[model samples]
Target: MFSGEEQGKVQIYTGCGKGKSTAAFGLAMRAAGCGGRVFIIQFQKARRCGEHESAERLGINLAQCPQGRGSGPCTSPCPLLTAARDILKEGGADLLILDEIMAAMRHGCLSLTEALSLLETRPAKTELVMTGRGAPQELVERADLVTEMKKIKHYYDEGLPARRGIEF
Candidate 1:
């Protein structure tokens, strides 16, 4: 966006690649640098990714939703959306990141209609970034800017754990 751009906006990162969350977190760090209050609701991941354990120390507020045990479902939208709704309604943040959210919706933890409504319910002034693999085509279309990370190769194919500071 140009420096003189209008209000908060929408952006999305998606695809069958390895860097969606990494890209989104990079944006979060940028937003924090601009002094924008931020909240990250990571779905379908447990065991503390390096970002979760470090965001607060770096001063970005985070709330990893308890949606899945390991790379799977996110079935509790009422609670999830409620939290998001409250924050947007109160206008506490300049930006919000829905990390790995589609996996939740895809796995039946969140309703598509409700999840889609965030683009509407969110105070128009709230900027949002959503990141995930397998993101719905509809969501990609709804976004103002959408980047797809196409995977070429990954260590997961070689039976290696995600490398710290890189895979993350």
Candidate 2:
């Protein structure tokens, strides 16, 4: 049972395989179940997904960047980055999930320094989780827990598009 008083830790789920967001969402659910406030900020995404619906039902706060997918690296004054900064400053969430943040970093939408700064300034009791591929070694080294989802094989390679609810 979660005490609901333990200090939060930084967790990263990254790799080329799938389940990174799924794993983070699972943690979000678990945290919420334990009576913890949860907030999720999805970077470089705009389309509504199954998680958005589930998040509402579960009382988790979720916000997505309007820039959407395949826009390339975001320029200065990225809305997602600004939103993240504001969320961190407000300081009410017990668990904060920066969904696809690593992908944003990879695409240059967000910088390593900014991400690390966010980590440094977040509320001490707020648990942080980042999801996406190609997580930089710097983040991995600083994280308290890291899980790499290696892709040995995927159905996407078989000409199957992402399915609703399952992949979205």
Candidate 3:
């Protein structure tokens, strides 16, 4: 496994909101903009409708879960956990984002302890960010930064579908 700097920070983007992953990806892009290597692991989100393409366009390394839109809790295997561990192990990136991981774990697609253990073991100096809804308390406790997106207002309530560059 790669060894990172002595210390850095861990962040979590949670709560019922639309921009969790987008925020984390923004941070990744910011780092990459400065020539920092970035690695992203998107769990339980296989549709290419999100920021995946934009993040990739920034030249960040990305590993997406094996499941797709129709795939859910009963999906064969949750490769995201393993892939995330691998991403941390192969460290060198300034930032690593694990998007939509919490919901997947809450659905029994992943063991919370396993995910937490992996989250704790990344090389030093690597900034890590995890995004999803309903993040466990334990994960939240360990995070140095947390952003909760409250759903006070949204166009989705009006029977409107997600729009490009907005909801997706």
Candidate 4:
């Protein structure tokens, strides 16, 4: 929506390895650098993470809906899902990042059907970005660009925890 002829594309990042959300956030930052407004909605997260911290500093519109840890699948009408739906309907930003949304769908916190439906209704000029592992085939087909981060090796495999500012 930054330019008159700019057509927003749908991008998806998914895989077993890390950096899905990170990549999306990086794109958001790049868009912001170009004077584009960015809106990020994080799902199925309960605690404050590095992304949220960075978003605060960058002054991006970041909404986090933390679904508390539980043994069973998440409840219907999840707060995160609702927030995503609202954002899609409202169309408030040039770049919209739905971080970890695929995970929410896979975890049963959100319905894939509804998610796709809402996605169809998003504003034409809003670039859509989705992140998380196990993305549905339908979504993969719908996305204009898709990246999968395969984990051939990782430091976490060697008992290294996620570090702040590096992995959050």
What does candidate 3 score on TM? 0.87
The better-scoring model by TM-score among 2 and 3 is 2
Encode model 3's per-residue lDDT on 77-101: one tens digit a residue. Answer: 5677777777788876678888887
lDDT of 4 by residue, 76-168 (tens): 777766776777788777898988887677677778897798679878888999998888999999999999999988998899887877876
> By the TM-score metric, which is better: model 1 or model 4?
4
Model 2 agreement with the true structure over 1-168: per-residue lDDT tens digits? 145567888999998988999998998898888787888999878999888899889999988877787677776867788877887788787889999998788778888999998888787778889999988899999899999999999999999998996988
**Evaluation by TM-score, superior candidate among 1 and 3:** 3
Off by over 4 Å in 3: 1-6, 73-77
Q: List clashing residue pairs in candidate 4.
A: none
Candidate 4, run of 10 with poorest lDDT: 66-75
Q: lDDT (0-100) at residue 131 of candidate 2?
A: 93
* Stretches > 4 Å off in candidate 4: 68-75
TM-score of 4: 0.90
- How accurate locally is residue 30 in candidate 1, as Cα lDDT from 0 to 100? 84
The lDDT of each candidate is: 0.75, 0.86, 0.78, 0.81
Model 4 Cα displacement at 106 (Å)?
A: 1.9
**Model 2 weakest lDDT span, ten residues long:** 1-10
| lDDT of residue 44 for candidate 3 | 74
- After superposing candidate 1 on the true structure, give the runs of residues whose Cα lies further than 4 Å from its correct spot: 1-5, 70-78
3 versus 4: better lDDT goes to: 4
lDDT of candidate 1 over 1-168, digit per residue (tens): 213355777888888987888888888888888777888877666557778767887688777665454534444443566777777778777788988778777766577786788778776677888888777878877888988899899778889986787665
lDDT of 2 at 121: 77
RMSD after CA superposition, every candidate: 2.7, 1.8, 2.9, 1.8
